[model samples]
Target: MQYNANSPAEYIRQVPAERKPAMEKLRERIKKNLPSGFEETMSYGMIGYVVPHSIFPSGYHCDPKLPLPFMSIASQKNFIAVYHMGIYTMPALMDWFVNEYRAHYKAKLDMGKSCMRFKKPGDIPYDLIGDLASKISVQEWIDFYQNSIKR
Candidate 1:
């Protein structure tokens, strides 16, 4: 599940063939729907969408050298995972996603604090994920992070 990739395309290329289409579609949804100012890259070994240093020069508080990670999609050992920092930091966003997910899918939601795991790639909710990606803007995220998450 750990791919030694240098870029998003490289990371997608390393995904298992069976899951490649799902990964590609997932990436496409995020890219198309995410608000302006987010950049696509490889972060934490997955395909990540981030607020680059040009937008927020302070960088991530955990690692000042790294950009502020907003979202990431990864092909894990047993599932495809989507990590969204906004849902983790903002309770309203989390609640909205939870309610919306129930409305969209019959399957039970498999989620963690910040990671949503889909055991079957075909079951992934691409539109719902796209909506989630569009929910936060760069400035909103930066403001929220500064007010609520930074230590």
Candidate 2:
């Protein structure tokens, strides 16, 4: 969970050998389906997909230097984690994702508000995850973030 990598490549190299393949596959799926404007980088000691500073000048409210995080993939001490901010912020989207996952995967989702923890590659709902990644555009996320702050 300690992310020391200065780059995405370095982050991949740092993942434990046992968990490397699954992490790589998950990363690939996200990248392939990720909406335009998000950039991949090392953030919070994980591989983060974020709205770059150029797209959202204010950056993340929590930390200006860091980009607005959209999603992240990390090899944790106990499991691989996929974090999706879009679903966490929107109740409707969260409901849709949960329904889709239940229908297709037929297993209980090991998840928090934004984080999906997987014990192995098979535990992931790859197609659904990719769709979720593509659900929101950068502008939408920025708007949502800004709106949330005003309330």
Candidate 3:
């Protein structure tokens, strides 16, 4: 679950063998679909996609030294998790994902405030995850975070 790796590739390497493909595919989907300007890094012990200081120098309000995190994927004890800040702060995006998930998968959605959990790696919805990754741009995220979440 927790890997002491310095890069996304290393993190993937440390994940369970059974989960390697899913994790890699998930990472690929996020990377291919996420808008430009979000850099990939390891944040909060997971493979993170962030708005770098070059784009928003203030960085994360909680820790200005670090880039503002937008999304991350981790292999948890029981599941593979996706943490997306947009769905936590944007009601419409949350609603859209919740609705779209039902149309994509038969099993009930397993999720938390910002974490989407998939107990079975094979069931992960790569396309929907890609769509979610593309929904918010870096500037849009910063604007919303400043006005709403950072307040």
Candidate 4:
């Protein structure tokens, strides 16, 4: 999606009317469960939580001009997507998350390396998403990100 939004509120306001409720609900859950250091903003054309520049001045290794992104949610043309950077950064976390989802939710874990796409918010396991979000602190993520790129 084209992410021209200057703020998270503006991004939400710009989502299609029919898709608003589901997006809003997922946003709320994400905020409710998000860890302490992450800041919410518009990133990659979606509502994103990131390790702010103040905390991680080097910014994203891929693009140092931008903050280090941790998680994000977006309303797409055909589906809703929740992006978890932790899953891509840490293998054990992904394994634990996928296992928990299969053992408890009983649905096929439909996901890419970091993005989990679903047609509806209810189809997602928010608590599990939250757990992923809460897995690490800003410093920990920065270290992980930096270490990964060195490989």
Q: lDDT for each of the candidates?
A: 0.95, 0.89, 0.95, 0.84
- The true-versus-predicted C-alpha distance at residue 6 of model 2, in Å, is 1.2
Please list the residue runs of candidate 3 whose C-alpha ends up more than 4 Å from where it truly belongs after superposition: none
User: Which RMSD values do the candidates have, in order?
Assistant: 1.0, 1.1, 0.9, 1.6
Query: Candidate 4, after superposition: displacement of residue 101 in Å?
Result: 1.1
Stretch of 10 with least lDDT, candidate 4: 119-128
**TM-score quality measure for candidate 1:** 0.97
Deviation of model 2 at 109, angstroms: 0.7
TM-score of each: 0.97, 0.95, 0.98, 0.91
Give per-candidate clash totals. 0, 0, 0, 1
After superposition, the stretches of candidate 2 with alpha carbons farther than 4 Å from their true spots are none
- Inter-residue clash pairs, candidate 4: 3-45
Structural RMSD, model 4? 1.6
* Model 2 poorest ten-residue lDDT run: 119-128
Lowest lDDT 10-residue stretch of candidate 3: 142-151
- Expressed as tens digits, the lDDT of each residue in 1-151 for candidate 4 is 7656898888888888877887887888788878788899988888999999999898987899999999999988788899998887688998998888987896567799999888765677877777777778877888888888889
Instruction: Indicate whether candidate 1 or candidate 4 has the larger lDDT.
Output: 1
Cα lDDT for residue 142, model 3? 91
